[model samples]
Target: MASTPAPTSRRRTGATRERQSTHEGFLVHKSGRWIKISAALAAALILLYIFVPLPPHHFGSSWLGYTLGTVGALLILWLTALGMRKRAITPGRWSLKAWTSAHVWLGVLLIVIGTLHSGFAFGWNVHTLAWALMMIVIVSGIFGVTAYATLPRALSANRYDAEGAITEKQMVEALRSLDRQLHDAAQPLDRECAILVDHSLEQDPFTGSIINRLTGRYPGDATREAASELRRLRAHRPRVADDPLDKVDALLTRKEAMLARLRRHLRIKGWLQAWLYVHVPMTFALIAALSAHIVSVFFYW
Candidate 1:
């Protein structure tokens, strides 16, 4: 008699679904409550801007403009506080996750507040310069949010193989393993092929500029060139299964694939980090300009 199959398959599927459902990103934490709150705040500010009476030609010196400017300045300071908050790990209601969510949404709100405060009056002056710098900081922050949401999964997938997930250290070790095998395999080869193998071995996989890290383009990739050259050299010769050239060719091919994966990982990492370079510096510039704008206003008043 055929026995009924157990419910293990159904249980495993349910567990997987549960895990996926529970995974909460800071951007969407608590159904994006911070984002909703920020939206409401921005809407209220926009409506206030529309209804508030003002002179026919208004500048930031106007009452409503001063209010928005105050709000925007406070928001900028609070947003900057995240840089410090991130270093202090904590949990619960005021968790790092909650702070980050607030930071992102409130930062977005600054665009509306700042633009309204400017009264659409842009010039080559300190006030307009502050607004422009604020825009740069916001745009860079948006890029960072996008990268954080997406790149980790790509990085994880890049590190996985038939054997399972590997760490950054493992990736380096894999490359070293291939290099050692190639060295041993090519020991019996002639001068020309030996030089090719040595070239591949001598090249550092991690040696590249920021552009190379971003683009994943290695025009002088020694392993790739050596692999192609060895394959070409073997093409005209008789097929010999035990040839050291054949082994070296296989090892070199594997090394090329591994290096490609490692470079791709680096490129993804570079994207994840590149935004901070702009965000942090521009934030400081915005603060300086903001200080100048405030001083100029009160000084001239």
Candidate 2:
């Protein structure tokens, strides 16, 4: 008979528990079958809506094919709502991933069924406008899905820390180190202005909303302003031949490069974020358009 030894350390036991929990959380579990079933049902419904004939189905005046068309349109609206509801929350069992998959495929279904529901009828009217809006909504949703799939993970990775929190603290600490070096070097460079310029760059001339970050259209005339200060300070002073000061400038340049990279990483993070402005607004507009279309169908019929 043999008995296995247990984990000898509390840390090891805790780590094992954490891994087990994460593995359970990430398991395929029940979603695969449910997703397949939903996809199949949605596909079948789309096909039936497009091809099936219905009579005594008054759109507004004639309760014939229009009746079945209304059903399909409502179904799409319902599916789209599921996506909207899931937007503000984390992806759980009907997670963002599932909602996105459903939104994309169902949107494709909308194109086929919505067009059929219209019976090839389109004119320059509010009715047609709504259909146009739905198309825009669906396209923007694809952008949303793409952004979520790609950017967030990268942003977390660029933090260079595994806990998944991207902190501005790293940038602050880097700048502080650069400032200390710049201060010690400035006195030797023949004036303090050179050091001040270095300080200002570390301060990052940019700030505020997502657009400003994405555009890199930083505020203030820092470059010209700093150069002006340098000109004033250097006017009559003999050029310093200190190798140590030159080395300081070189070190500052390296710090500048690091700051630029942080900004670039922030800019990429901004692009991933800003598209949602278009995606969300367009979705709201689609609901409005689809609603108008539904109303018009009943009103005209």
Candidate 3:
């Protein structure tokens, strides 16, 4: 029989292989130690640039500014690439979270870099428009960041998951369940009850624009039609006075809550979706403007 490996030897080999296989994250400063070192270096560099006066302005006087601008451009391009990627978007590390952090801090650094680039000079020109556009892009980016960073947490916290993310089928099922409950609870006198419940769940998602959502103005032809149907039904079958009606009333309350929850969830997601409509196209416009500014500054100057 062949000799078997010792347990300790096998364990040692496995541990060594495991350590070797693990990949460090981007920039390769995998541990907290590297984070501390990187932070110290960044702080030191900033302090050096701030306090240590340099020689007279020259060809590369704004070298650091150019570097920062290039970096920012690369980041914007990278974000665009991310958009192009059809795979699922994720939150942290090499993902939107990491991109966002880069965006925030690098943007903060841009203030330093861009100002130094101008040598604090400003005039009415294409260059000024580019700068203005940069500021606008940055502001919009800030808004995008703020909107996404907080709203997801808010959406999670505010949403009721007892039913756990109701869908169209679920809404229909809930209505059916209510209908079943209503059979015993609803009086023969209660008018057109099922129709009202159906209308409530059947509200279409794409009913109006962002403004309509903001104002809760869901009213439209469909809504008006539904309301009219409900009214016509209710008039013919007079209100029922029965104790079992209490259970029907309670079922109505539950269904309403579920419908409301679903609508609110869809609405909030819609808001998040709408922000990109402004943020992305503006970024493209900014890139065009920035390119024009760069060319004019170098060629015309």
Candidate 4:
């Protein structure tokens, strides 16, 4: 009788699959029903603006203009309510996700409503100022949506390494470990090489301003400078198997690479947050302008 074949072990792919997230973000919520609804609403408003008869040389004082203005004003109030609605978490049909989805799509719809309400009559007045503020808010919101959709993946990819995903704390710990290793490795080197290592170690990876964070440009990166200088110093020197400078150079190169990754992460994160700095403040300005527009309209009437 033939001997029984050995049992084959199955390769577990669960860890690989578990690493990826399948979460549907708020923008794509409910198969983008809100997007469809908003598109339809915008289309209808445009048709009304085009087909509906208005008096010759008419302005925003027409009945259709008043209707669109009313709708636009109500939409603005509802859009603003999201700031408060987001604070309270609720489940089911009217969930925060649903509200966010509606907020985004309906906010886009405001562009059509607002433009038609303006009757294409732009001038340097409170009305035009209100429209300008609304456009600013809408554009900032568009940036926010794009950032939310794309930056998260970039952020996750930046955090991953051959050792898999790392936490913020782990990034700092790894840098510290590399620094300690560089310090130990530089001990046997001459004073010049030791100074290079010291310079690399003393540099802070997170010392850049907001502009540096956004641009990912650290002009004074000591680790990078040290690595370049060590490479040049080693160019003419004969290779030694146990050269202390070689180890320090290699460690400095690694520290520089790690700092680059951190800076890239910061850049992506800065973009993710920078829009809010404009969106929130501009929203308040839009509200104030809207209030003035409304008051001026009634005050003159």
Q: Which candidate is the best by TM-score?
A: 1
**TM-score of candidate 2 relative to the true fold:** 0.63
Best-to-worst ranking by TM-score: 1, 4, 2, 3
Cα error of candidate 4 at position 213, Å: 0.8
Worst 10 residues of 4 by lDDT: 7-16
Estimate, for each residue in 237-268, the C-alpha lDDT of model 1 and write its tens digit. Answer: 89877888877877887888889988998999
**Against the hidden true structure, what lDDT does model 3 obtain?**
0.57
Sorted by lDDT, highest first, which candidate order results?
1, 4, 2, 3
Give me the runs in candidate 2 sitting further than 4 Å from their true place.
1-69, 72-104, 161-166, 190-203, 207-212, 215-244
| Global lDDT of each candidate | 0.90, 0.61, 0.57, 0.87
TM-score of candidate 1 to 2 decimals: 0.89
In each prediction, how many residue pairs overlap at the backbone (N, C-alpha, C within less than 3 A)?
A: 0, 8, 0, 0
Q: What is the lDDT of residue 47 in candidate 1?
A: 90
**Shift of residue 52 alpha carbon in model 4, Å:** 1.2
For the record, the alpha-carbon RMSD of candidate 2 to the native fold, in angstroms, is 6.9
Q: Write the per-residue lDDT of candidate 2 for residues 30-126, one digit (tens) a residue.
A: 4444446546765775676556554324322334345546765676667657645765767466765555555566665566555655555578977
